[model samples]
Target: MANNNVSAICSCCSEMDGIFSRLLILTSSITRRLIEFFEDILLRDVNRLLRDSEINSYGQSQTSATYASSSRDCNSDTSIAFLDRNASDLDDHHSLTNSGLEIVNRNYHRGVRFIFKGLMLPLYCFEFAWGSVIASWRCSCYHMRCMQANMQSFVSRIVKTLHGSSDDIGWLQSAPGMAPVEDGSARFVELLQGIRNGLHKLPDSFVYLLIPGLFSNLGPLYFVSTKRFFSKMGLACHIAKIHSEASVEQNAWELKQYIEELYWGSGKRVMLLGHSKGGVDAAAALSIYSEELRDKVAGLALVQSPYGGTPIASDILREGQVADKETRRIMEFLICKLIKGDIRALEDLTYEKRKEFVGAHKLPENIPIISFHSEASVAPGVIATLSHIAHAELPWLPQFPGEDRENDDFALAARKVPVVFPVSAAMALSALHLQLRYGEKSDGLVTCRDAEVPGSIVVKPERKLDHSWMVYSSWKKDPEDSSEVDACEMCEALLTMLVELGEERSN
Candidate 1:
């Protein structure tokens, strides 16, 4: 589809079949890109021909008086301004097509063109029957592809979790131009020096409390090699012992109590360095801690944490994999009972739940909070965009039987772009679903926008890291897998910032 075209929601259906469940999205992506190839070629040439013919006719002498302007097809034609990839072209609001006939993609079944350039096929009595058949087939294909893709994805993740190896697989690869990063220390040496200078007046007794993320209970495993680097800076860093998969509210309350009596009541403030859910929990605890207790809590440095709940949590919790309906229930039972995790941990991370929590509790005043967020998906070819929500919501799409036409407006559709790598067919569905829900690209787990807080200072030169890569260096096979190392340095800087801010407030 052209850059000017907007996406619409699909009307594809699903049958109770297994093969279609997984391959449908992959198939859909292939089909949609093929359609784009054809459309891009045909549309561009047609417009060029029309534009040239008009120019030729305009140059003819006495063309206006002798050749009646009323007879010219210009009035019936819609002018198309061929768009380009420059940032300025995004502002083109022209909604007209060359011949004034709307073009629909065979796969996406959506888009708007200012100039009509296709065959003037006359509609007959078969229009209803044809549309009905197409809609039915679309729905069926969609469901099957989703099912197959998800099943394969779930199995792959399980295999990876148990065996700790799957890099040999042909489907997954480091995205083009995404090589493993060299050691992170080199990137932040200048920044670290500047921070050290600014915070040189800090007291020697302040402690750095490292709060690990969900399922991160093993001491400093999430922070990887960065803890040792901090110890060298004369900071006493300790990992908090809260249950990994517990509710944020519960963990926050518990963490609050632990912090209040920490350091044998010596009154040294605890600088919190939290990752993922740990970050969210720390923020919640800071909101509830009393002024005296809150005073002891120095600052917060949240890394790759979802301040807004991730849609993946809701999708997995509420709607299990199409191929495995019991995956959610079974995982909950096993993790909560065997691993001793709180069953409601997933629930606490829902968007609605977190919004309610933030609304109910206010953060402590004058506490310096620095946040770092990351959102990245493999930038695959046409296939990547197909799975994205933007492509799924084109306005020219056939409406589902259950669609609310009143809410389906062309203006609300997202612009389509072929970006993001669908790691698996299952991830394709996730990418597609997320994009449809939020109309934004995401790092398989969380949208970048959701990871940030309103008042926090974001690190410059934002890292293009993914959620899992923030902690585990082994998520990808590439050599540049040390974002967690960089993040640790960022946390150290924030810790220093907190001490500097505290001194300024005290004086």
Candidate 2:
């Protein structure tokens, strides 16, 4: 009985061993197959990239040959140089011939033969390492080519749109350029000086509406200072309470309704002043519902607005750009999932969407428009500048109904903490990118060219102001300047210019 039990135990152990061996074999097989699958994919991609490179090189070689032929015609020494170069290349190739193999075979001792055979292992290892590097290089080249092609195509389309072609007349040619943009910088500077002296005050004939830009919802203080400044002058000033993260069309509709409500309540035309994406939204409102809004809105001043399109948006969201899909996914997640905002809010700003939207809806020629754009300083000192984003209100301790709230020591607990960030650094980086890549001047967000609305009076400020500088106050104030010209004064100057333009149009 004991012997039989021991044998059963041994048989069970043997069964477990067999199962483990089978599992190991299965895992090895799967791993080998996976490696082979990846190897095949790598080879395919590398080959495709190589073929593309070859095609491009062939064209370049043909061009070079033609040039060389022409040069040879001019001087026979050129042909001799070319021939000598080709001969040297041939000599280099011949250097890698079977001379080594012949030497090994000549000294074919048993030990030498074994050593030669053993060298195959290290040779294969070297081949694998070198192949991996080549594969990576080729893959990088492939993606680079794709990115270049995408950029070229995008640029070509933009160029075509800028310069009218036979098939499609450029939009820029027929769009707002028909009216011609007036240089109002000199006049703007004078008005700004008058504003600083508190001379050119806005008339009470219109209700001023300040529309905030993207992420305005998060920063409750956005346009708050500007509104307060306007209010101090006893002017009917209000910030348009619309979701800044909403699509341009959606915001446009909201803005239209808001303008109508303001007009009906106050019995006055709304003077719309918008910053960044807000400007785009306001313009869309006027364009889409021109018949309705033309009578309600007095004028529009787009401050640092990308009315045409932003290259930053185009590059990130553009198809076929390097890591385009990945970048879009990241942006979508951040905008939609994290911020609870629509992706279309950002997508609408892209070149493709802007082109389509602008083509469909044109801004009314009657409304006085002012395009304001500034270049941000890319100096290292600017990076240290801080921007006031919002205030964090801390929770206070609850008191009884009859308790004196003013005397409570915990009243100070609910004190608002100023939230600040180094937004200038980000702006400087973006401005640097735009400057380096496109040789375009930008306010760290919108390029000067893109901000200029063709039909409007363009205000190109000499002062180096960033995108955030127009709306948010900077922590560091220049003490050297005796006259401190704030955002309020700048805004007043813009509106003053708009008023003049309106009178000019009327005359």
Candidate 3:
């Protein structure tokens, strides 16, 4: 997997580009702040004489407070406001996730391939002498451990969701985390069969619109292959032809146009099933578009959608690489281009950006949203030996900052405004930026906390389900591959449920 070719694109080269861009933002921020600082000093000196003459004309302290309050308001509206991230909040050395991360970090060494670095001698020797067997062994060992500790739970929850007899699923809609997700595997299969029957027997009137994620139309390539798969099951599903790489607003507008232009039977409501960013974009469309369009939509099934945006978005914004180079190019070709030339798209996926969009728009009051989010990870893996550790030991990644709130007034005067906020190195970035709240449970993209959209029926976090696996390669052909989780069967079941829900709502 090492890109050692002399002319091939390098991750470090991308990293350097990211560093350069951040520096630009930092420079501009610094220049602006310095100008303001000098302006304040001059104004203070000039106002001293006036203050001395007037004696009680609006006390300086009071004026300062008024200005500060206004500045806070403006800052909240326009900028990303960060909660005080204490050092205590990080480095959860007591969990399996951390341990797994450490294992990966310790042995799976990254050799810099760029000739410009002029530092290939050591890694080359290691690769040539040992034939890279040591590195391979280290990676295999860690992956094995991840499987050993996590596979049973993963198979039970995710695997059982498909083939097992149990119906217990962690439901987020209510207080009870564990509830019946299905009657049984047999009943679910019957439901799947029923959906197929209905679709085969039904007329053109029955249409379920599938909206793909970021950088997609029809869905991701893997998702696209499943297109005729849903149709054969008896539902007339059409992929919403949306510009997958556009901002949510842009995508929404396009969707609004598509929905409005559609020819539907009298009183026929359309079913919308959006995956990943498509779900968020669909919500945005319904939120901002006309009520007429809202009336046409039956219900939305958001599958593994990031309604609150992923922390990875922040990582990409501060870093130059987007999903690595090859995957990035595939995304570009498949979805009208992704992050290489389009940084704004990445910016739009940041937590702050999503928050702004959600806050500004109102979710329609009547339409039902059936949202399912799945994340599989354990936090504090660094110290998994500590059995007493509670899942909540690490706070949830701050999605809208509800439970991890700091006092708004905490050391307000002493806080230094950051001219250039720092970003962590990308090597173990996920391990470091993980949310303690969800116990670092993520789909390799969105945290479960962030995925849970308020005022919707939600499936509580499902283990063994990573971001890519949810839509692409849920089950590995080889058991040796630690990353795979059997998600395809579970996903098909969810779609059947959505079709059933849509049928009920449409009628």
Per-prediction TM-score to the true structure, in the order listed: 0.47, 0.61, 0.44
lDDT of model 2 at position 75:
75
**Model 3: how far residue 333 lies from native, Å:** 16
**By TM-score, is 2 or 3 better?**
2
Better of 1 and 2 by lDDT: 2
lDDT by residue for model 1 over 356-447, one digit each (tens)?
A: 77667777657766666654544455234443210212347566676665454443233222233243344445555566655656655666
Q: Top lDDT: which candidate number?
A: 2
Give the per-residue lDDT of model 3 (tens digit) for 9-115: 33454455567556656755775566557555755654564446344433553465456556676565332322122112222322444465456443332321233
lDDT of 3 at 227: 54
Show model 2 residue runs off by greater than 4 Å: 1-178, 385-418, 474-480
CA displacement after TM-score superposition, residue 392 of candidate 2 (Å) = 9.6
Q: What would the per-residue lDDT of candidate 2 be over residues 1-507, giving only the tens digit for each residue?
A: 544554565566556656755665675577556655755675566557655755675566557766777767877787878867755754554453345434543454444446644744675565567556656755665576667667777777566433321221123435543557778899988988877666966798999999999988887668876886788688999999998999999999999999999999999999999999999999999999999998898899999988887877766677654556788999999999888999888888876788898878889999999999999998877766644343444446565676655455554334545667567789998999777866778888888877888788889888888898788643334778855568878999998887777888889
Local distance difference test, candidate 2: 0.77
- RMSD to the hidden true structure, all candidates: 35.3, 32.1, 40.4
* Candidates by TM-score, descending order: 2, 1, 3
- Against the correct fold, how does model 2 do in TM-score? 0.61
